[model samples]
Target: MTPHRLGIVGLGVISAAYLETLAACSTLVVTAIADLDPDRAAAVARTLPAAHPMTVAELLASDDVDTVLNLTTPAAHVEIALGAINRGKPVYGEKPLAVTLSEGRSILAAATQAGVRVGSAPDTVLGTGIQTARAAIDDGLIGRPVAASAVMVTAGHELWHPHPDFYYREGGGPLFDMGPYYITALVHLLGPIRSVTGASSRPQDHRVIRTGPRAGESIPVSVDTHVTGVLEHVNGALSTITMSFDSTATVASPIEVHGTEGTLVVGDPNTFDGPTSLRRVNDVGFHLLDPLAGYVDGARGIGLLDQIRAPRRGIARANGELALHVLDVMESLQRAASQGRRVETSTDADRPDPVPLTPRSEWLAVQH
Candidate 1:
C-alpha cells in the first residue's frame, strides 16, 4: 500500500520516542521534518535515510507531503496547526493544544471553519491498560461508575528536562503542561466533563535545573505549581484532578474509578500500553479481575510519535483507535468552554486501520 506522506514539525526529545515507535509500523512515511533550530532539524534528518530537514514553509509546500504533524512546543501549537489547517491538511499535534485556552479555541475554530481534520496527543487512553478498563466498565464488570480521581505530583520538569523554560512559562503550568494525559484518560473512560471548578497556585518561587545542557540554572516560576479542578460529568459522576510539580511525592492512586461493584486501578497515561488491573466486590465479595490481555491502540501510538526516524507505511483505521479518539477528546475540550452545551463522544470516531488492539500473547506488568 502507498504510505501517507508525513511531515513533522519540531525535533525535541519526544520526537525521538515517536521515531522508535514508528519503526514498528508500516503505514506512514516521514517525508520531511522542520524545526526552528536549523541545526537541530539537520541533526534529526541525519538519523533518517535520505530524508533531510526543511523549513516549516518548505515542508508544508512540498508536494510529497500529505499530513502535517505539529510537534512544536506547547505555546506554538495553535499557530502551527492553523497554518496546516489553512492548507487543508490533516494535523496531528503534540499536546495541550496550545499554551492558553483562547489560543486552543482559535486553533479549533480555524480547523472547524476549514473543514480540515486535526488530531492531538495523549494517545495512551487507547492503551490496553485503559481500553481493558473501558471494556470492563462497558460490560458492567465494574458496575456503575460512580466517580473518578487522578493525582499527578512531580518535583517539576527542571530536574530532568534539558530545556525547562516552557513548563514555567504562561501556558506551562501544572494543569496545561501535564494535564492532557490524565484528563484525556478520564474523558475517554468517563465522558466529557459538565462543569469545572477549582483553584490553582504558583507554589514555588524558583527552580534549580538538575539535568540537561543547562545544569544548576535557576528558573522562574510563572504559572501555578498545582491546579486542583473538580469535574462534574453529565452522568452524575464527579472527578477530581490534582496536579502539582512543586512536591516530590507520588500519589496513593494516580488514577482511580469508583463504581457500585468495583474499582479500577489504571497505569500512568504517559506510556502507550500497560497492564491494568481491576478489583471488584460484587455480591460474592471482593476479587481482583484478571489482567486484561489484549492488543490496544496506545502501543501503536508510539509509532506515531516516532514516525520520522523510522517511517511507517500506512494509516491505521480503527473505531476507538488511540490517535483519533484522543484527538477528538482534546479537540472537543478545546472548544468545550464556548459551547455552553454538553459534548459527547465515543470510541467509534475513527476506523482502526493500523490494526485492532487484540489480547497480548503473554502477560507482563498486567497479570491475572
Candidate 2:
C-alpha cells in the first residue's frame, strides 16, 4: 500500500513524540509541517526528507497531503479540523476534540458531510496497560465490573511547561488538559457515560511560574483548579474521578476497577504501557498480569496508524466519535458542578472493539 501523507499543523511539546513514532512507521509519511512560528516549522522540516514547511492554509490545501494531523492548541482545534474537512481530508487530532461540546459536534458533523474519517487521541488506551486490564475483565477474572476510580493530581503545569498560561485558560484546566486520558480509559474499560455529577473549585487566582525562563512571572487562573465527579455509565457501572492541579501528589493507583469477585489496579492512563495487577477476593495479594492485548511498545502515532488501517479492520479504536463523547462527558461534568445537578450527556459512543495482543513487528509492518 502507498504511505498516507500527513500534514502536521502544530509544533508543540507533544509533536516530538508523534514525530519519533511516525518516523519509523512505513505506512505513514510526513509530507508537510506548519506552525504558528515559521522558524520552528522550518527547523523541524529540515530534519525530514519529504516534509517541507508550509503555511497552515497552504498545508491544508496541499495536494501532496492525504491527511491532516491537528495538533494545535484546544482553542484552534475546531478551526484546523474544519479547514481540513472542508478540503476533503481525513483528520486525526489531539484530545478533547474541541474546547466546547458544540465545537466538537461541528467537527463530527462536518466530517460526516465530507465523508472523511475523524480520529482523536489519548490513544494510550489502545496500548497494553489498559487493554491488558480490559482483557482481565472480559475473561471473568474480575467477574462483572461494577465500579472504578480514577485519580490525577499535580501542583500545576506552570512549574515545568515553558508556556503554561494555557493550563489555566478555558480549555486548559486539569479536567480538560489531563482528564481525557483517564476518562477515555474508563470508557474503554467500562462503557459510555450516561450522566454525570460534579463539584469543582478554583483555589488560587494566580500561579507563579517556577521552571521556565519566565520563572518569577505570575499567570492568572481562569478555570477550576480541582475537579471531582461521578460518571454513571450506560451499562450501570459507576466511576468516580478526581482531577486536580492544586494537589501535590498521591499514593493511589492511577485507576482501580472493582467487580463481583476481584479488583484490578490499572496503570496510568497517560502512559502507553505499565503494570496491571489483579486481586481476587480470596487471594493473598495482588498478582501482576502479563500483557494480554493491544499494541506492544506503542506510542503516540499508533492511533493515526489505526485510523489509516480502519478500512480493512472495520473500526478505528481511537476514533472521533469516542473523543466527542469524552468531550461531552467533561463538559457535562462542568455543567453539573456549576448548576449543582446531575447532567445527562448529549452524545453517545459505543465502546470500541478491544485490541488483541499485537506486536510491534506486525503492527508496524507496511500493510499491502
- The TM-scores, one per candidate, come to 0.81, 0.99
| Poorly placed runs, candidate 2 (over 4 Å) | 366-368
Candidate 1 runs further than 4 Å off: 282-297, 300-356, 359-368
Query: 1-368, model 1: which lDDT tens digit per residue?
Result: 56667788988878876676554445556789899999988888887664669999888777777778778888788888888888877677787666654565567677778865566776565566666666777778778999998889988888889888888886676766777788777766776555565666676778888997789889888766777766766577888888889788985677888889888877776664655667778444434455453344445344233232122333322111343344444334433433544355432232222223554331111210
For candidate 1, the per-residue lDDT at 53 reads 90
Q: Pick the TM-score winner.
A: 2
RMSD of each: 6.5, 0.9
The TM-score obtained by model 1 is 0.81
Per-residue error for 245 in candidate 1, Å, reads 0.3
Candidate 1, 271: how far from true, in Å? 2.1
Compose the digit string of candidate 2's lDDT tens values, residues 130-223. 9999999989999889999999988999888878998899888999999999999999999999999999999999999998789999999999
Whole-model alpha-carbon lDDT for candidate 2: 0.94
